[model samples]
Target: MIVEHAVLRVRPGQAAAFETAMAKARPLVTVQQGFLSIEVRPSCDDPEIYLLLIGWDRIESHRDGFRQSPDYPHWRALLHHFYDPMPVVNYYGRSIFHD
Candidate 1:
């Protein structure tokens, strides 16, 4: 399996709204193929920082699948505005502990 990691830095005072929007957007992703799970955690030290982790069957499942699907535009519209400089996404696979 592959894990998608992204650190989202939301605009000041918009954390609540961002979370709410994320809730609405979650369904769009859940319906996609190869989707295992999605998780978002808020930083303890800074409310604006969010840790996003998504489980996929493979890297292309996200990069070439969901991101290419019609729902992607909707997902982007609902949540992209909240980011200031935007977030960088990275992928990890086959953890050593489990391997």
Candidate 2:
């Protein structure tokens, strides 16, 4: 599995707007191929920071396939404005972790 982690720092006073946008925007992932699951969590220490965690079957499923789809443009239009300075997205594969 591929793990994609993004830290979204919303602009001040735009938290509600960002959350509402995400509610409408997140479904785009479901329509695409190779989607596993996703989670969005608000930071306890920083209210403006949101943690976006997504799991994909393969890295290409998101990095290549999803970005190439026409829907991404619409997705970008809907959510890109919410970022303060734009979030940095990082990807990783399982190395070692257990519960």
* Highest-scoring model, TM-score: 1
Q: What is the lDDT of residue 59 in candidate 2?
A: 88
Q: Against the hidden reference, what TM-scores do the models get?
A: 0.97, 0.93
Give residue 73's lDDT in candidate 1 (0 to 100). 100
Q: After superposition, how far is residue 58 of candidate 2 from its true place, in Å?
A: 1.0
Give the per-residue lDDT of model 2 (tens digit) for 36-57: 8999999999888899998998
**Candidate 1, residues 1-99: lDDT per residue as tens digits?**
899999999999999999999999999999989999999999999999999999999999999999999999999999999998899999999888964
Which portions of model 1 miss their true places by more than 4 Å?
A: none
TM-score, structure 1 vs. true = 0.97
